[model samples]
Target: MKPRSTGTANGCEWTSGTSPLLTIRGLCKSYGTNRVLDGVSLTVRPGRIVGLIGENGAGKSTLVKCILGLVPHDGGTIDRRATVAAIHQELSLAGGLSVTANLFLGRERRTRLGTLDHRTMQREAAAIFARLGVEIDPRAEVESLSVAQMQWVAIARALSAEARLLILDEPTALLNRDESTKLFTVLRALRGRGHAMLFISHKLDEVAALCDELIVLRDGVVVSSGTERLEPEEMARRMVGRELEALYPPRAVPQAGTVLRLEGAFGGSFELHVGEILGVAGLAGQGQADLGETLAGFRPLRSGGLTVQGRPVRFRSPRMARAAGIGYLAADRLRDGIWRDFTVAEHVGLGDLPRYTRRGHVQHAAIRSATERFIDTFQIRCRGPAALVGELSGGNQQKVSMAKVLGAEPQVVVFNEPTQGVDVGARQEIYSFIARLAARGVAVLLVSSDMQELIGLCRRVLVMRAGRIAGCVEEDPITEESLIYLATGVHGT
Candidate 1:
């Protein structure tokens, strides 16, 4: 069947002069009883950056998937005049392969004999790297590259495809301010070259600055679409279906009680204090991941002392850290968070099995009850506990990851970009959850490149520069300007 187009009267059109380069109309999709996309419609004109904003489960990803022919939409029409390229939230690069190999894997330049062209691919890969304003060794393995570098490589590969329409989903999540600015510069250059882009991001300020038009989705439907002239607050209200009084909740004054502390912490070179949510911010290469890994026991600290409740603690491994009442949630959920092949029940129950299992055997009934409780509590959209984690949406997958950590009941919860690709509503929910965790006296340490996320969720923000604590600011002093000043090493109040 021909897919139905979603660019009907219900759709938002930025231009009235001519037809768009790509048009979507009546896009409807569902998984059993769960209707993900309900007649969602949109349009993207040539040489325009179209911003797609929505709450979690608002059908943004589903719409993109349908356009990419990954998920078969129940009813939709996607009309396109040119080839489409997408940079998904999940890194699509093969981890085992080298950077150059992944970039030209399927679309490699070949000889008449149909063999792989190695020299040509490497040379072209280096040029692509140069174009992106970064110097990455083409021969280096993908596994060795940092998350931000890997993300750049993915974008370079997409650009190399010479696509007319490029879709970037949360492309700046892992990048620091400098790196992100460079990326924006590249994107603007692309826009100048008449490349139509569908930019999906949770950063409202970025959407306002970059996009020529805005399309907002809510509950799997197109609620608002217009020229990029609306106020950020207005745009957020439309996406979330409510007015937000304050983006960040009021920070509670830290009491004198001991929570968690690090004495002369020498992971690389930094010291962490109790009752502080240190905001580790830098240009992804500046040792943020290294610090997080060290804190989580994934990497060894050269010579450091970690303490909780005024007692010296030793965490040699992640298991040891968990045993010490410290929980670490990795930024890459697909790799370290959830077991994708496992069922939802299995995923949620994996961390809390000891609590449910009394004797040597496991308690299936107890596990089911616990999973159901988490699903209801978190408002997780899924078929059932029996459904595989891989089958769920990105938002739902993140919820599963959170459920696993929350089930463990740790004293200190270190969240590494908890809401990287999550939509607006899910972000709000996650923030609320984090606040509750703090209210319950669980020391929350968040490492996020997102300024708004750090400002909103954290009480006291410590800016990390070049693998050390540059400066610290309380909530009263926490503003975008101040955070950027510390992050970029500028002087400000």
Candidate 2:
């Protein structure tokens, strides 16, 4: 094939293809009777970023595993000519160690006497960070750096091993808008330098913006593959095998009855009405997350109090909050929402075990039946209720988390970044689910950093800044400009 020349992103020259870095032909993988990947074929060439798009349980993760050699493929051949590395959604860097130490954890430089060579490691780490256009300090603790910086560190570690083909899985799931932009800039720079990348993301707009080519997977097969720039809607359609009409469902008019009210907390007072989708919006670390945590009883209110339907209450723990008809969907699903090792039945039953317990014994059959109901209701894709939560995709795991939350039958639900790492199809499903909750007279406090989510679905939005409610935007047509002004206090130029 002839090489295609693309304009330079930074200072490096960009050419399309030259001796494919990794090639897979007729790849097949399965888990017992269920086929995960079937006859999937793709090629990653240097100087190009390829987007691997798919819905939950569509075999994207399995293809990645097969490439990384984490799992043996059942059939087909993978002809790889270069070193490969992966950057997963969850970072693998040790928090207790310094950036340099974490980068060279397993492969450390050895001195003539065989002592730990901290100085040489720090020097090499600094060099890699500089090459990546990042300014992270090598001697700094990994935990002390920002999420975006840590991602850069992960990329640098991969590159330090002389890896030619890089696999990134949901790298921006934890980053804010600005942080994500910076990450994209660095990635483009890498592309300019002829580094092959397989970028897996649920955010289609991001894939549209960054990828030079698109490979859409559906139902364990490659449905579409091309270099043409496709719209997000078209990509979503190809991924799900249907046209997605709208991302956010129709908004419901909230009732006048107040379901939850907070007094002297979050530097102000706010009331959530029945069937209302009240949005809590702000920049990162600006007290919005704290507001969600406090409402869900993860933390104590310093001097204020909470009232559920006019009944004054102070919750000391999450269990206390649940007992008071409050449910919280944590932002970090893997860490707080769902347990990886636990089954779907166990997840739904752990929080509401009393409903299944009888005669001083936990009823396993009752829990399984209830879990199956949730599986159908949420459209969670899995073998059955006995499937481990870890084995499911990010979107399915999120569905299970939502099922666990709604199982408690709470009057007030606090959804923290409800679609953080979910795909477009699953995101729409979650939006409809939230709307249904509101239609059922359940109040929802949506704490999210996604501006479109705030504008698209919220009836009223409260913007927080510097540990206080900066302003409230209830006007019709709440735009991103208004939210940014309220969030950063930068009005007229």
Candidate 3:
């Protein structure tokens, strides 16, 4: 079987070998009462890239885990003849380690004298980065590199071994368009080398561009697959079982009231009105993090004041910000958003403990009840309110984080990379939820590097460039080209 030509992937062609490289049949998995994977089947042939996509709770991650033997499946047959490597979605490389050390941390090459061959490792690391078209100092600490650079290192690590199969989970979620294009070029090169890969991402366009074959799961079952090709929108519709009436809900008109104003802000001094999604758009490290953190009280302003309803307020901490009706959702849902060891009920209850407490004693019943409501409202997939928050998928964790913020009943909500690692189907729902929040008169401050997101969701966007405001884009004038131009300051004064 051969895939139809796709321009997004630079017209790469692949042929399925006479025999399959990997075959999965009748896979089954269950967690107590919830059946995550049921009767799922697929074949991954050599010299081809396969795309796997679905909603957050759609069992995409579960399938990957089962195939990788990372988890035990209930009933399944996985036949594999090729060595496999998986690139994680999180920080798989240690920050304290150097790039050279990280790439060969476990599988270090050694001389016959039983000594670690540091020289060979360094030379090989450089060669790998060169092949991937990325520049990284072998001795440079992993902590110092940018996200794109780290991703390149991860890719190098995966290819470092002579594995024929590579699995990438959300490879470009944090990267910008230019970075994504470079990554795609590397992927095309890998395909040219007759490497088999599985590309899993929430970005449907990316899947369409890179995959020679596609599989989409929904509610623990495969709903669509193609030896031919499927459009991103069509795949999206099948995944969610509904037409995308609007990928982004309609934006509401902002009132004549400025709910929150940042005076002399670090990234960009901007005013957010009630019922508006004020976007902060820029490339990574252009002070967008500063803007979001400074607003959320995670960082202190050097020479700025935040005014709420004309009253100047100084928040020294996140508690102070929340007390002043400012709710924040950090980009990293695991690190800053929720407690991994905590239960779903505990995570949500921490948002507004007062509502779940009577007297000084904690109300366990109230907490459980509130968590149940939240789980149902957000459609979070878990065993129950007592399930560990970290055990849930990335999308569910994100929903829990959003639920915590909404429970705070804040007048101002700040979301950093609102849908960073979320799948396409879940992304639409989250977008609608955020839109509804804005419609309900919540002043939302959205800071992200995704130009499409900023253009699709924000009515007005403030483009940041090198810690300063480059331009303010209104609804009519906001485009990917315009946002990138303004963000990079490549076209106007």
Candidate 4:
């Protein structure tokens, strides 16, 4: 192949052909009898991003896991000797460690005396965040950050490694619009510097805008591959087809009842009608959590009280909230929804084991049956009920969390960023479940940072600003524009 010049960056030209930074041919992975990947082939050249697009459980995450050496692909020729690194959807950073520490934990800079060079790591960490167009404190602990903020730390850690072949799997799943934009800017800059990247995301728009080439995968095989970047809509159509696979399950038939009611509360008062998907939306830390936490009993309600099914109640803790027939699906699934070492079956029976108990003993049979039911109902992909929750992909993990929540059969469900790290397909499953719950007269409170999520899935939206409800947008005027104006106070209500 000829060494043709595309464009020169920093005095070096990125050319195509014989020397791909990473190449995979006839890759295959199967779990027991089910094949997850089959004969997948692709090449990622330096200074280019090869987007891997697919619906949830369509082998995208499995493919990256195979590349990262985290999972064993059954068969394939992966001719790669480069320093390969990946930042997966589920973050594995140390919560107690500082950003600089997490960034350079295994490969810390040391002086001749062999002591860690803290100042150097801090400076470099700060520089990496700045380059990514995000402002995060290098000294801040990972546990003290939001989901979006934590995602930046993960990106910083991957970039700081300076790997030759970097793989990012849904890195923006938790990020807001601004954070995602910043991340894209940094990815483009890295591409200019001759870095090779495999970008896996459900956000096809990002794939369309950032990737130099795209590969669409479906049902364990390659469906389409394009050398040139494709438009967002076209890429989306290729991935899932023109007609959506019932993105949001048809709204459950409406019912007249009151599931949760808050009086004179922070972020203003709002009553959750039974079967209503009430959206509490705003930018990060703009009181979305203030309302969600209060309702979930993670934060104390100071002024007014809560009423469940027309009965006045006050919750002292999350335990109390759960006892009151409330299901709280936190925004950060890893931190709040999961026990890292627990199994799928164990997580399924987490909050309410009594239901599975028989004759003063925990009935393993009952738990097994329930696990099977939840797996089938939630469409969770796993190696059976014994599979460790941590071993599942982020999307699968989100499904597990959903199963855990809905398994309790609560009268009301509160989801704070319900689809944060989930893929487009899994998102539909989750949305369908929420709607189904509402159709059954179970109220839902959806607190999301994604404007589109709120507009599309919610019937009533209350925008919060500075810890108060700025305004309300009902079904009639519930466009993204109105939500933005209400959240930012940019336009007259």
Winning candidate number (lDDT):
2
lDDT tens string, model 2, 1-493?
Answer: 0122223433223334687878899999999999989999998899889999998889988898888888999999987666688899999889999999888878899899999988998899999988888899999999999888899989988887767789999999889888899899989999898898999999899999999999999999999998988999899999999878788988868998998888887778889999999999998889998999988899998878789989999889989999999999999998999999999999999868888899989999999999999999999989899999999988999999999988889999999999998888999999999999999999999999998998889979999999999878987888888899999999946
lDDT of each: 0.77, 0.89, 0.84, 0.80
Q: Which portions of model 1 miss their true places by more than 4 Å? A: 1-19, 95-100, 112-148, 267-283, 479-493
The TM-score leader among the candidates is 2
Evaluate model 3: give its TM-score: 0.92
Each model's TM-score? 0.86, 0.95, 0.92, 0.86
Number of the candidate with higher lDDT, 1 or 3: 3
lDDT of 2 at 3: 20
For residues 1-493, write the lDDT of model 3, one tens digit per residue. Answer: 1122333342323234645666899999998888999999998877789998888888988888887788899997876656677887785899999999999988899999999998999999999988877889998999999998999888888778656678898888878788899989998898887788889998888888789999889989998887767888888888888887778877667877899988776644778999999998888778888878877788887786789878898878988888889999999887888898999988888999887778888898988888899899888878899999878888889999998888879999999998999877668778888888888899898898777888888879988889888878885847887787888778654
Provide the lowest-lDDT 10-residue window in model 1: 1-10
Q: Candidate 3 — worst ten consecutive residues by lDDT sum?
A: 1-10
Tens-digit lDDT string for candidate 4 (1-493): 0122234553223344436877789999998888889999998888888899887667887887777777888898776645567877678899999988999988899988999999989999989987777899999998998877788787778778656678888888767687778778878887787778898888777777788889998888988997866876566666665455656665554478777888877746778887888888887678887788878778888887789888898888987888888889888888888887999999887758878887888877778889999889888888899999887767789888888887888888889888876667677778888888888888888999887777777878889988888878986647888888877778754
- lDDT for position 354 in model 2: 86
Clashes of 2: 0
Number of backbone collisions per candidate, in order?
12, 0, 0, 0
